[model samples]
Target: MAIHIIDEANRCLNCKKPKCMEGCPVHTPVPHIIQLFKEHQVMDAGRELFENNPMSLICSIVCNHEMQCAGNCVLGKKGSPVHFSSIETYISDMYLDRMKVKTAEQKKQNVAVIGAGPARMTVAVILAQNGYQVTIFEQQDKIGGIKQYGIPEFRLPKTILSRYQKKLLELGIRIRPNTAIGTTLTIEDLLRDGYASVFVGTGVWKARNLGIPGECLANVHFGIDYLANPSAYSLGEKVAVIGMGNAAMDVARTALRNGAHQVTMYARGRRIAASSHEMAYAELDGAEFVFGKAIERITEKGPVFKTSIMDENNRVTGYEEGEEQTEADSTIIAISQGPRNRLIRTTVGLEGSDKGLLIVDENHMTTRKGIFAAGDVVTGSKTVVHAVEAAKKAAEAMMRYMEKEGA
Candidate 1:
């Protein structure tokens, strides 16, 4: 692995106008980081990466490089792109353990981060680094939110998140795991308790239903709930997966791993919603795909799919007259998810969009003053890099807000 990374690093042209950086959501200084690696300054490269995006290591593993950084590499037009993801993982994994986190002079002001997902985790780190007292409230027993529950373990190991937990603790950030903010402790309660600013990054956890008949049947399961704990389900050898997004791919692959012999995914249109890399891996993992099949409803036996006719652009134009029900032991829905309304319902002055997502301004401050938001709650479910970028901006805005208020 070291030799491969070195070879890839050497292949970099070190462009003055690096397209890779532009393609990156967080605008990672790809050329400079690679130059640092080439010059045996691996720690410096890692520090720069972590400073720019606190979730650099996690993003290196989970970010859609095929659509972002590596996809925009100039070499990719002719051949394979310089796989910066591998190099980044190498530097970050090394630096995470050894690098010393320095904080500003200790401040008395406190900040509350609602949710321990990618966005709030970034906020906590940045605020803690600036010497502000920070506390994270997570609904789960552990952190990582979607990184822990939504994404499958084969793609991103849970141990990396565990290491990040230790790092956050070292930064003097307090974590209140399994404590949901909306139920007993409201946002209003936090503000009253001397929290200068509150950041809400509670991700989209509500599983979207098909609304069709037989959805409540025992044989049917939602993707979000299943990925959170695949071991809990007893999906037999023949598992029928609904939807074709990245999460659908994960479900198919995970089902295969958990003793499902035949895993097939159904897509509404000819084109799938998942990234090519993920789709390729799912195929490599022996998951089958059937396109142009719109699920009408799920039955106790399996999902009933209607034959969808597509236009030239692969859009679903119409569906055939009848539907066909396939045989499967279980049906899993992976059509995506929406944010829950618990926080907004419980908190006064806070507003959410029609979709139940938090309403935030340019600075990421929500409708409520001094309460900021980012990540999936604001922009729907997106990549980890986007969450980091959003949280960095929100964290800066939060500091300015606190400073102006004399907190």
Candidate 2:
């Protein structure tokens, strides 16, 4: 089974200098882990991956392989790139069945991480491993922020998220759900209470609203709200997604999954520029796209909505122009952008952009010393892996600061 899997894994030319690792935000050891699996050392492979990424299992299933590790594989130059994700998943599954040993001794530094999302989870794990008592404060009742709420069941099952949460608990990281940082307990309280340091990883949950006329109509809703409460609205037979980004793709695909007869995506950019690889997968899954156009307005017509499209110059380019007004049970706006600013302002004294994203330095540190921010909050919006990577960097920086102060 191992040899068959190895041969089937697609041989890597194994570039003299591997670019695959460079392409990964978390810098996972791609080729080495694959080689370990190829050699039938599945447990070793799992250990290798775990050393770099705590969320490997979740990522192996959901990551955009085309844009990351596998996309940069030199083997792609010949025919197909190595099936890194599949191989990684296989190794992870095998190791998960066995009893793996912990490699580090626990220490005693108290660290508080805000937001139970990917970035905060990563920081919590690393801090715990380094002998720190890590406590995560999440406003939501559950640990996984967007992963639990924003993403749908089909792509990322709740079971997978629950499993990761279980792992974090086993690692000695404390998760305080239903606890909002700025609301339940302020940063000053955490500091005064003797936390050595606090890392903020609250993701961007605020949806960007379409400023066009008629957006506030009862028939219109933001994608986040729609995904957050799928049972609340009766999705009409036809629906239109107002963006071509991944979130837009997610909204469109989700609409289709919920029984919408037709789903269309509107993008102001070309297909290549607007859609991500995951979005392309969404396209293959039956979401249609109308590239290079923007929705100008939405007007409710009984149970339907009439939408107008505009060109780059803001002139009316097209519409359901004369076509029977499409009955839209709900017009979803997937274009809102922002980080949770209240926490940032209260904790770190950092200002957000007009768009509400936190400003950060190259080290992923905010303007406030001893405080760092990452993930969607810092990058505006990005993939889960990107958030994990940013969190890892922030954790390392925080560790260095703690060490300096201790020394």
Candidate 3:
């Protein structure tokens, strides 16, 4: 089912010096893993990937290949790059059933991870592997965060995500879903309860508003809200999505999937305007685009909504300016933004940006000692791989700090 590996593994010049590894964020050994796959050592290949990334399954599906790993492949300079992502996917799928690697059970220290997202999960896994008893407090009823709720099943299947999650549970990571850290339980409380360190990975769930007039109208909704609860509302015959980012594309594609007759994505920028590669797939799924135009206003006319558009400099432009109102039954706002900092406000000595993401040092340590933050809560919405990298960094830093304190 994976495309990259099925195509490229056989074509690998098996370069003596592979540039693909050099381009990876965590520098995963690409050539060696491919060699293992070619040799039918699928489990070994999966283990090699797991050595650098615990969220390999999720990354395989969501990674921006054209930008990372495969993008830098020397083979790509001449021909199609090795299908590294598909190969990685195949390795995970074929071997995950046989490999029974569990977290090391040494019980050396205690760490409290907030939010059950990728960052929290990664920190918990690393800490657990090092014999640290880790407790994860998640605000939601389930783990996986946006991956479970935000990403559609068509893109990321729940079975793959569940398998990856099961490995964490086998590692003895304690996940307490429906428990919020800065609210239901404070950081001070976690420390008082004997946690050596606390890592926060609460992601940005609050959607950004367009601040236009008709936003307060009945059918206008945040793209996340629609994606998060698809069955609640009918996407109807026509829909206008307000942004060109991945989320906006998801909304448009989702609308099409839900049987919407037409879906149009509006962006103030050009066609290359999308922030991620997933958006390209969404375009291929039949989502239309209205680029280089911004929505000025949305007014309701009878049962439909009229959206006015303008150029970057506020000059009237788009179909709405020429007596052709962009009529849609529903308007989905997909402008990207940050989290609600209600929790960070209660923590002493902790500060956030004006945009409301928690500020942390290179080690992911907050201004407050014993507190570290990662993932979207700290980085303002990043990829699963980035969150895993941050979590690994934070876990190592926490371990060093604990050793220094003689904990």
Q: Give TM-scores for every candidate, taking all chains together and pairing residue i with residue i.
A: 0.99, 0.88, 0.91
Give lDDT for model 2: 0.75
Instruction: Please give the lDDT score at residue 55 for candidate 2.
Output: 72
TM-score of 1: 0.99
Candidate 2, residue 12: Cα displacement in angstroms equals 2.3
Give the C-alpha miss distance for residue 89 in model 3, angstroms.
0.2
Which stretches in model 3 have alpha-carbon errors above 4 Å?
A: 1-7, 271-277, 301-324
| Candidates sorted on lDDT, descending | 1, 3, 2
lDDT of 1 by residue, 198-283 (tens): 99999999999989998999999999999999999999999998989999999999999999999999888877779999999999
Q: Cα lDDT of model 3 overall?
A: 0.78
How do the residues 297-332 of candidate 2 rate in per-residue lDDT, one tens digit apiece? 776841223455666665565655433344455678
Backbone clash pairs for candidate 3 read 4-83, 5-83, 108-131
Q: After superposition, how far is residue 252 of candidate 1 from its true place, in Å?
A: 0.8
**In candidate 1, where is summed lDDT lowest over 10 consecutive residues?**
264-273
* Cα-based lDDT for every prediction: 0.94, 0.75, 0.78
- Displacement of residue 8 (Cα, Å) in model 3 is 2.3
Please give the RMSD of candidate 3 to the true structure.
Answer: 3.3
Query: What TM-score does prediction 3 earn?
Result: 0.91
Give one digit per residue, the lDDT tens place, for model 3 in 1-407: 54546556777767777788777777778888888888877888888787788777678778777788889998788887887888887887776666676666575668888888788888887888888888888887778888878888888887876786677788787888888777767888888888888888889999988677788888788888888878788767888888887777778888888888888877665644455666777778888877655676776631222344556765556544333357788888888867978677778888898889989988888989988888888878777788887888888999898888764
